[model samples]
Target: MQMLIIGGSGEMGQWFATFFKNEGYDVWISGRRGRSDVAEKLGVRFTSTPEEIIPECDVVIVSVPIDITPEIIRQTAPIMKPGSLLMDLTSIKKNPVDAMIGSAPEGVELLGTHPMFGPSIPSLQGQTFILTPVENRCEKWFPIMRELLERHGAHIEIITPQEHDHIVSIVQGLTHFAYITIGATLKELDFDVQGSRRFMSPVYEIMLDFVGRILGQNPWLYAQIQMQNPEIPNVHRSFIEQCERLSKLVVENNADNFCTVMKDASVHFGDTGAALHRSDKLINAKVAEFEELLQSIGKEKGLYHIYSGKTHVGIVEKVMARSVDILESGKLVNLKIENVRLLNSDELNAWKNDNLAAKTRDISTYIPENADPDTLCHILGKISEGISCKVHDTYISPDGRRSATFRIDIRQDIDINKIQDDIERLLEGIGCILR
Candidate 1:
């Protein structure tokens, strides 16, 4: 199957292109003002525009910015082949779905999809995918697309285009507006966000993370999301009014009335206890990882960069509030705590297998008279993905017990001293003793 994604050079577009390619489709991408370099890196074909290639594609996805999604849909849908699918991955569904219906010919299936997560997400697992499928419009393709997405761990939600917009107005619109407003207000106040972290509690730290996450992304995309959605103005107004009301309450220092307002709002907000529990879990998780880093000082630890997908395996010499200093090959590399995942032992070894040089060692161990030597070797090989074990020799020890020697080939950069105890444990599991 051939799938063409418009705006393929963009973040979400590139993400989908890679996704479809992995699903065995010959993916093609059309970037409006983007270079083909991005498509090349994504291992997908690149086109200058959607017009020339839309008819040839089995699936045409319009993933352009929200402002141009309608126009892009109109231009590409007319040329799409009958029995093929035409879809939009825009945030706002109503306008683009309308355009697809108006411009697409009778047999061309139409679907309006909004992926609630961003490109930064590692996988489809636990991600929400909103589908705005029109009645009698996408009967043939809707089930196929929904099933495919769900099979890969996407949480699919079926809703009308108008309903999607209405919900997203609060979901994306209100939250984004509030966070961006906080960021802008901080700028206006000349407040140092980094310096404020020194005195921040867990809740404050988490809130600052959300604000920074928004402020770091593309401003143009955020602007289009806020400006193009007609329903967002009402949400924004409601949020601002609520903020002003809270401010006025604080200004008047009316303790009884303020408590009444808070109690009413708490009653309206469902599951506050569950929300608090989840937030506590998040805070505890952060503290646990930080504690691990602290314990890893003067030890070989591995940290995987979330965005770059690079693994840094080195001695951890220093740990700060929001950063860590890794002594990698006599060079100190500072990494942000938020931007990296601390690798477990298995993960660290797996990374080393792909990057480090191979080394072989012959290990001899005394086995129990009744224990199977072959089974012990099998267990040893299963210890790590980076190592292979083969039974090399068997002989009698000086004490007259049966003994087996294995040739262990390690392709990972593992410290032999640390792995030696692990090997001894494996041998002892089956009543075997290490030589």
Candidate 2:
């Protein structure tokens, strides 16, 4: 059997293309702008005109952007052979499913799929794929598709397009809306996140990390998700109404009412203790991972500076099996290795000479909106010779301005003034401003 994926250059399209090709199907991808290199890398054929490929393909998966998916479906579905299976990998199902059902030839099978995970994931293990079968004239295709997906460790959930949209309105819509609102509020307040780290708890840090992750993604896609879903307006209205009601309780200083609201919400959630236990496990795992990373660095005999989540600098005297020995202001302290970061080692000699005293500086800067965290960290590492840089906080304004606060560790030997100047210059060269 042959499979063709439209919009093959996109992340999801490439994922499907690579998967089908690996499954020994004759796989081909068609996009407006074909990249031979990408096709070669995925071991699939590529073509600019999808129409030419439609007649030959036994299965055609439309894996384009959400907004353009229906148009693509309308154009390709009629051309597909009667025995071929037609599918779409859109996030939302209703519109695309309808388009596929309406435009496909009489005997073509139609299935609308939404794979919950993105392309960065290595495999589909533990991932959810929602399948909305619009038409299944080809009786054998649905089971075949299910088996293929399950073989690769994907869990399939069958639902109608309307049901999928309703659930996603809360699952994707409300969740993204909440985070986006928090981000906007931070931007509006001109919050100094890096400066506030000394007061942050692990839970707050996790929330901020999640916000940053969302803002780092494609804004257009997220906007489409919020705007295109017909059910989202109702969800947003309900959310806003709840927020208003909560604000009224706070404004009136009604402690009893607040308690009542909390009780009601807890009851609605239905398993507070179990939820807390699960969350605690995840938090513990994160802490363990953090400690393991620091120990690995210490094992390499790398001279490094450590920072507690409190944003305080500690002199790492030694990394032990369970804890790290540090000197904070002439006081020797043992910290759980997971609670500290061995992020900087450039001025190890200077720190040693100064009796392990490290100076902490909060440097605020602005980078291009939506810069990759890894790339930004790499650039900072290259420019700052002896200073360890950690992103204490990042926020993006509504107008697309992205700002970050970095915590830099400076040793006594390095000239603090000159280093600051060098950092400013390097940042400015990369279209970033030192604030």
lDDT of 2 by residue, 1-435 (tens): 888888887888898888888888998887777676788888888887778889988999988778999999999999998888998988788999889877888889888889998886779999999988864454768999999999989999999999999999999999999999999999999999767756876677777878877887888888988987899999999999999999999999998998999999999999999999988887787677666555553232222423322433445566654466666556666666544555445443334544545577777877876566556666665564456777888887677788888776766656888777777777788788666
- Which candidate number would show the highest TM-score if scored against the true structure? 1
How big is the positional error of residue 411 in model 2, measured in Å on the Cα after superposition?
39
Question: Clashes in candidate 1: how many?
Answer: 0
* Candidate 1 lDDT by residue in tens digits, 303-421: 99998988888999999998999999899999998889899998887778777887888888888898787888898888867778889999987779999998887774666655666
Q: Enumerate residue pairs that collide in model 2.
A: none
Worst 10 residues of 2 by lDDT: 300-309
RMSD of each: 4.2, 20.5
Model 2 residue 90 lDDT score: 80
Local distance difference test scores for all models: 0.88, 0.79
For each candidate, give its TM-score against the true structure: 0.87, 0.69
Candidate 2 runs further than 4 Å off: 294-435
